[model samples]
Each structure stands twice: as C-alpha cells, then as structure tokens.
Target: MRHILSGIALAAGLLLGAGAPAVAQNPFEPVVYVNDAAVTRYEVQQRMRFMQVLGAAGTDAAGAEQALIDDRLRDFAARQAGIEVTDEGLQTGLEEFASRAGLGAAEFTAVLERAGIEQQAFRDFVASGVAWRAVVRQRIVPGISVSDAEIQQELTRRIETPVVTRVLLSELIIPAPPGQEDAAMARAREVAGSGPTEAQFAEAARRLSASGSAAAGGRLAWIDLENLPPSLRPVILSLSPGQTSQPLTVPGAVVLFHLRDTQGTLRPGAREQVLDYMTLRLASAAEAAALAARARSCDTLYAEAGGAAAAIQRQTVSQNAIPGLIATQLASLDDDEAAVVNYGGSADLVMLCSRQPALLAEAEAGVATTALADDGVEAAVPDEGALPSRDAVREEIFNRKATAAADAYLAELRADAVIRRP
Candidate 1:
C-alpha cells in the first residue's frame, strides 16, 4: 500500500553495513530468479535500506524480502503487458519523489548516496512504480465500471427505512489458465461483444465457466449488495436486471454477470454527497494527536504533513467507495472533524473537509479530477479537464476498483511465473 512518495517505500532500508559483521559473499550474486530475471542480494539489502530511509513502520528483514519479491512480480507483469517507463517519466517520478521531501531530484539522490544507497537502486525502485502505474491505468482502468445504482444506493441508504435490498445475478466465469491468458481474454471479449441473451449466456456458462455454478447454468444465489466486492458493487448496480456485464477479470479468470432480478422496495434518498477527506499518517500516536489538534481542515494538513506528501492523502469519493475501516471512522464525523486511529505503532489523523452534495461538489471535482500515483493507492495530483460530478465519482470508483484488479492481475502473474530462490 506504500506509495512512491512513501516516507519509505518497501521497508527498512537498513543502513548499509550498519552493524552486521562483514561477510565474504558477493552483493551482486543472484539470490532469487523470477522466471528468467534475477534478484541480487544487493537489491534486497538496498531495499531494506530504502525502508530504513523512509522510516516505514514495522519493517523487518522478511518484509523487505517480500517487498522486493513483489517488485519483481510487478516489473514482470508490466513487461509482459508491453508497458515501459520513458526516461523523462522516470525523471519526473524522481523529481516528484524528492519534492515530497522538499528537495530536488539531484538533492535526494545525493542524500541517498551519502547514506550509502546506490543511485540505480533508487531509480529502479521509482521506475518499477511508474511502470506498474502505466500497466494498471492503461491495461486495467479502462475496463472498470461504476454503477449509478451504487452511487444512488449510498444516497438511498440515507433514507432511514427498514427495507432490504438484494440482487439476483447469474455468473459466467471463464478460466484464463497459464499460457492461455491471451486466448481466454480474446474469447471473453468475443462473448461480451456479441452481448449474449440470458439463455445463450447460461448455455455458454455451462460449457465454458470454471466456477462451481457451471452445473446450474452459471446461476448464483441472491447476494446482498454489501456482500459483493466493492469494485463489483457499482458494476452490479449499473446493470438492469437482465443485462450481462463486460468480462470482469478476477485473480484466476474472467467473469461475466447476468443480473437475473432484484427484490427490494427501493426509494429515493437524499442528494448524493461526494466526500472530501484528508488522511495523514504520522510516526506515532502522539504525533497523530498533535496533528489532530493543529489541523482543523484538510487544507491545513498540507502544511503540517511536511515533505512527506505521500504520507498524506486527499480524496473526493462516494461514501461507499471508501474502505470499510476509513469509512467507519468518517461515519460520525462532521465537517472539519478529525479522529486519530492507530495501526500498530503508526497512526492516522483522518479529517473530513467537506461533505458536499453532488451538485455542490461538481465545480471542484469536475473542473479537475484527481490523478492516482504511488502504487495507485494515493491521489497526489489533479488532472485538468471538465467532467460532471457524477462522472468524477465514476472515475474515482473506477480507479479504486482498477487498482484492486491490478493487484489481482499481479497475483495471477505471480501464480503463473517460475519463481525460484538460488
């Protein structure tokens, strides 16, 4: 979940030879192989030092190794997708990273060098992040969707009624086994492009789906709205009862949904309010409390967040799109209200800047949409363009879901990869 702007990306960049006795091994010797690619011992130590530099919480030797392993997976997936980071893009990433620490790129590089970190180590780390982003935004985000129903559902939940809402959906899950990924995607796309009718889709599911429901014509039991994946909630809501979804990529396969029916007494609620909230993670609980006292609004936190821009995040999203934990924190908060939540030794000061109704937030969010960065978990900048509030909401939801799908995609890549430790 660490962004490039992370005070520390990966984890404990343990100082090079901080205390360990000198060993007679080569730093550059290959230690792990991700398919044909090699991971060197030097890279692992460098990553550990990178973690130390960023002051990452709870970082250990094992966490550092796993982080590097994941980096290889991310890099491997990006390459397979034909994604690359240009020199200019890499430089921009470095500049943005340094600016977070209130320094220029060159300055940050000098600081790392002084700490005995190699320049290429930093570059490779940043490049991995930049390239992975391209892989997600270009390869995955386009296929994401957010239902008007999801948005309206959140707004409807405000109705204070006792009515329950549920969906009846049929599934067509196509397995995308290793060495057959492209063929599977092509087939799924073919099915989607043709827009199969309910009967035809059911038959295809029975023939093609790898899910257990295949025997039952790909039919699934009724599922509560809250029970669905956060990404799929809007997707399900957007469909009319009888519609089929574009193929959705899960960890191991592509899935198509046919919403069979809905049985809920629906009623309109209040105007949709897209929330504007900012969260800052400080080093400790005491620092979080200090931030809570000092920053009364999201705008004020920018000054308080110091050079760690990635440590602070701001988002304008549908209430339902927010993660369960953060959403729970924001639930009872008022405008400009702040709360301190602890995670181990680390802590976050979450503040609600404004909860404007859709109409009211249109001007701010529509004029410029937030752009994602740093593993696509943080929104660090805004893009210039004109979009309606609803569309902006949709974009935010798509980014959230796309990032999640990107993770699933990465996992699939790992599963299919030939990883080995030498």
Candidate 2:
C-alpha cells in the first residue's frame, strides 16, 4: 500500500532519485467493476493513499478496493433515485472535506498531486459521499418515525429493564389519504393475507408502500424489542420467522410487517433524546411553501424579515416537551424536513435541526455512567445511574429504528449489485 503524502515536508520524502518520478503501476487497468462502472487500479491506489493520510493506516489495497466498491454502490443508488449533486453543492462538500485536513481544496489537491494523486480522485470521493447522504435523506429517512407513546414506553422499559432482544423485520406502509382510508385498508388486508414470501413482500413494498424504504423493499435490520412501540411489541413478538403481522393502522397510513428473525443481547439503552428545532412564522401558506423550498437544513435556512416572513424562533427540548401541535407536525418529518402548518392566524414552518439520544451520546463519550440530577443539585454517580429522561430514550429508540431501516435498504442494494473482477 502507498503512504499518504502530506505537505512539502512529506513531498521530499516521497520523491524518487534526483527528485524524479517514482516507479509507476498499471494505473488505468480495471481492477474491479461495479455494475457498468469501473474501478481502476489508479483509483484504488489513490483511495489507499487518501485513507492513509486521513489516518486510516490499517486500510491496505484490499480494504480500499472494498471501500471503493461500496462507494460505487452508493453512487448507483443515488443515480437510480435521480439525485444529482449540483456543482455548488459538490464544491461546498469538497471544501468541507478539505477543511477536515486543515487545508483549502486547492492546497489539499496540491498535496495529493505531489503524491501522484489526481484532483479528480478527491472530487469523486467527495461527490460520492455527498450523493449517498442525499439518498439517505430523500429515500430512506422519512419513513422512520418515533411516536410520543413509544418514547414514554421506551423510558419505562429502560428504567425497569434494558432491552435485550432485537428482531429482523420487513414492512409495507400504505398511505390512507383522507378520503381513501377504506380503500387503503382493503388493499393492506389483501397484502397481509397473501402469505407473502420475503421476495413477494419486498416487491409489494417497492410497488405499493409510501415509505422511503419502499425503494429498498420495506426491509428493516435487527431492531431492539424495547425500541419498538409498546402497543406493537406484543403483535411483533407474536410472529415467527416468515410470519406477517396483521394490517395495523397508524396516523395517515395502514401498515404490515414481516418477521424475519430475532436475537437477544444486553445493551445500555437511551434515557432521553433532545431535539433542536426552529420554526418560522409566515404570513401566508404560499409564503411558507416558498421558504420551505429554499430551506435545506437549519444551517442553510435563513430567517428573513418583513412581508411573507414573520417570526423565527429556535428551541431545544425533549420530544414530549414540545407542544402537541408542533410535536404532531414534526412526527412525519426527518431532520431538515420542514412542515407548514396553520398556527393561529398564520402558517408556521417547523424545521428539525437534530434529534439526539442523550444517554447514547454520553456512552459514546465515556460519561454515560454519570449525569445531572432532576433537582440540579449534583451529578449522579455510576451506582445511582443517570437522571431519567424519556426524551433521550425516545431518541435512542427512534435512531435505532431509522438505522435498521437504512441497513436493510442498503443490504438489498448490495445483493442486487453486480460486482466483478476482469
């Protein structure tokens, strides 16, 4: 594997005899092919070098090849979804990535060039990452939702018992438009009674489900039993592998599930989830729509003054702490998704910035064993445990559900993908 060359200092170390070019490999040779796209030996070497520079020293050529293959799959999924990274967006992405190494894009490219890595290699890598995030946001996230009740139930479970069981499941979520509830239910009943093979269920999900995972065949990875909704736990637990759940009704949709498998393990669960969101009041529905169109994320969505724009406020709180109307509006949304709702005499654009699991975040930081008490008197030690936050538990449960769905979708993509060496 090649070494990652840094600045001018590393440049001299990488130079050949008399500061001439080093020995070359068959750079243009196709080492691997993912579907119609080719992964050249040049690209592999560049990736290996890039990762090494990025501190992934353990990644050899073989590891780089697999990573590039995954990128190919990601790029393909974005293409299938008609997601194109705009030049401006790509540049922003490049700048962001370059900033990680404490260098501007031009400087980073210069360093890579000195190491014989082409500028296009860096662009391709960043572009692929940007496109994949778009795929997840646009094609996978909207379908995964955590309910208020589920949040409370998760808190109760975490306090009384840590979740030990995780289940593999597939889903079919059919939208029941205001006037078409009966029709949607009828269709859902037919699907549920079909005794679908996993393949058949996947096909149905692709064709009939309204979820983002519809593109991935309604598949979901192993999710903890504690993370599931309290009401649905019994129904899901009742199923055996290959058994489909009866059509279950949720707000605005009728859904069914297929149990694939189950497992058990001890894992620390979430105690609370904090939400950071912003809302902009608008004078008219049309105004809200215009603003929503311009809004990509909280960072990008600016609050304007006067006319159509009215008031903007940012708040952070647990899910259950949000007002009923605002919470309901946020339920169907993913991070960065904006929903326009009638709040009194005007329209409100509610945008979610982030929803985080407090306990999980602490755990990752090596501080889950300690936290603030409810009275604000002092922090709790390991034996006393952290203060209970239903919101954090809610956040954890929701994140796991979302992650499982994404994994299932990606698995389908990998399975259908054609990988080869020629």
Candidate 3:
C-alpha cells in the first residue's frame, strides 16, 4: 500500500499530469489475455493513467500490466458467475468513488480527462470491481459464519495478552520536483535541525508541505504505531515530543514528521469499550430538567419520552469514537446516569444505559467487515447517521472468510484457463 503522504502527493501529481512518462507503445494492440478476454494496450494505458490520477504508487508499465491482468481475471469470473453491474449501479459506484475525493462524478471525470484518462476506462474499471464483489457475495458468503464460541475465544485471548502503542504526529512534505532534491533536502535538514517549536513546525508545514494535512497545519489524528510503514516506524519511535525527524525521501517527495506525543491506549489490545445510550430531545430546558429529575434510570427516561415531544435515539459507540464534546460530557457518568445539554434550539437529555468491553471478535469484524460492507456489494446503502460501530462485526468476519474463499475460487479458475502475453 502507498504511504498516506505519498498517496496525497500522487493524487496532486495526477491532477497536474505529473509522473513518469507514459509507455510509448501502440495503445490499440493486444498485450495480454486472460482466458479468452484480451487486455489491450489501450486498456493498460487507461488503467495506469487512472491509477496515477488516484495517487497510487508504482504506476509503471509492469505494474499496470499486472493490475490489468488481475482485473481481467476478476471480470471473467464475474461474467461466468452471471454477475453483471447495471449502468445505473455502475454510475452509483462511480459517484461514491468520486465522493471520496470530494468530487461529483462528472467533475471527477473531467479531471481525469484533463489528465489524459478516458471516461469509459474509468467506468470499466469501477464496473469490474463492483461485479467482482457481487460475485464474491453470491459464491462465498453462504458458506462462512462466525460462531459465538469464536467471539468468546477471541475475548478470552485478548484479556490474557495485550499490545498497545499510539502516536500523535504532525507531518510536513516538501515536493521534491525532479532535479530539486538537493534544495528540498537542504530545506528539510534546516527545519529538522532547528529544534523548532510545534507552532514553528506547523507554520513551516503550512508553507512547504504538499500534503492535504497542510491545510490543518499538517497535524494528523492519533495513529496506532503498528499501522506505520516498516521503514517509517523506527524513525517515529526515535523522536521525542516536539522533535522533528531528519528529512526522509520518498518517491517524488521529501518528508519530515513532528512528534506531538506518544502514549499507550487504556489497555493493550483491549476490546474497545462501547456505550449504549439514549438521547431524548425535549422542547424546553425546564421540561428536560423535569424529565431528568423524574427519571433515575434510562428505562424511566424512555418511559417519560413516550408522552413528551421528544425525539429519542439510541446509539452504541466506543468512547474515542464519540464526538469529542459529547464524549467528554459522558466521560464522568456512571450507568443509569443522566446529563442534559442544549442542542439546536432544544434540550437533549442523555441517559447512559450500559458500558461494556466490546467483544474482541466484534471489534476485529468491524474493521474487516468495513471493506466488504462499504463496497455496497450485497445490500442497500446503510443509514450513515445511525450506523453503529460494532454492528457489522459478524458481517465483517463473514466477508473475511468469503474473501478467502473467493480468492481460492479465482486461483482455481486461473489454473484451469490459458493465459497469454505478447
């Protein structure tokens, strides 16, 4: 996977049509074949260009060729399975993909065109992905399941062993335009050696970093150390608070990271604690206070909410996952405790029903399941407003198993087919 900083730079470079020169070959000629499907040089060109536009790393000819091959295999399998992406479904997928970059489908296509990518190529690429996911769901999901015993076993294992490390980091990326490495390196060294305050570093980042985080003073959210790239991990681990790293070079960019702080999570690999709570919005502060006074328990509040002009909602979320202000307000409350806050011209009476360590299996499933669920393969779009953090655990686990099954199935298909390259 491309590093986040590199991905950002690549995206910018793609928008500006900056990258290694394109392969100077006949785009219409067939370059490879999967089963009976021909992968034209033109398709590879489009895929490479599109990948570049997406700030993907290693968008070289070989990489593009291999990616096109995998895509061809996936498409062929989807076709054999009778899975097809309707034009409407493809358009929705395009829109959702574009939304990630904060662009509408048309706007994103225009950007691609400006960068010399064809709109049809983008559509074909997305269609393959959508169809392949549907194929996975149909063929593999039925056979996979996560048992309650497995969840309990995972929970027990987590309780017996824990691993925890997290870092607060701010980043700076100086674009190393071709032939400007020395100048960029000199600037990086000067900044790194200056022993600058966090403010000074952030100011430098604002002026020089090419990353999206530059808009936010290059500050990043707290990240688990294990998520850092292997090469970058040691450098980050070595830094003290307020210290910046020596300039490091990545493809097309020179980078420095400021260490804001580092600390362990509450427990090493602890099951994330989830809170089940309800909030009732009332018309007036007096009414809210009256309800709060009358309700000593969450159930009582629920009962009081039935007769009042109240919009009640229940949500389950981990502490850190909650909005900062609300999390802070709820931090001190014990089970069955109530708190009132004013929101949007109304009083919100919140009651805490329960807090417990989420099952380790559920937490793992949430992360794994997100890949399949967010892909919109087997279901309608979920309600984003009411999505619970741990609700998808089982689905995620199922997806993971299904993904493995799908890969095996693909491998069997590949082995049985004759592939050709020219």
Count residue pairs with overlapping backbones in model 3. 1
RMSD of each: 24.7, 21.9, 17.0
Relative to the unseen true structure, what is the Cα RMSD of model 2? Answer: 21.9
Ranking by TM-score: 3, 1, 2
What does candidate 1 score on TM? 0.43
In model 3, the worst 10-residue window by lDDT is 382-391
TM-score of each: 0.43, 0.41, 0.51
lDDT of 3 by residue, 1-422 (tens): 23333433444455554443567777688988888789898787777667655645325567788877777888888888888899898999999877777778898787777767889988887888898888888887777889965555544444544333789999999987865654565577668768889999999999999999998899999998879986788788768788888667687777989999887533433556678887777887677778878888877776766666256787888777877656766777898888887675777777788775654435445643332456667445442222233335456666678878988987887787779977
**Model 3: lDDT to the true structure:** 0.73
**Tens-digit lDDT string for candidate 1 (1-422):** 12233332211222322544376889789888888789887887777666545544213456667777778888987888888889999999999877877779898887777656789988998998998888888778778878976654443333333233689888888886644543454566566666777788789888998989988888888888778876677778778877887666555566788988886642332345678898887788888888788876777777876686567888889787887777888888998889888887898888998775553344444543354576866564442122335565666667779879988988898899898888
* Backbone clashes under 3 angstroms, per model: 15, 6, 1
Backbone clash pairs for candidate 3 read 369-396
Better of 1 and 3 by TM-score: 3
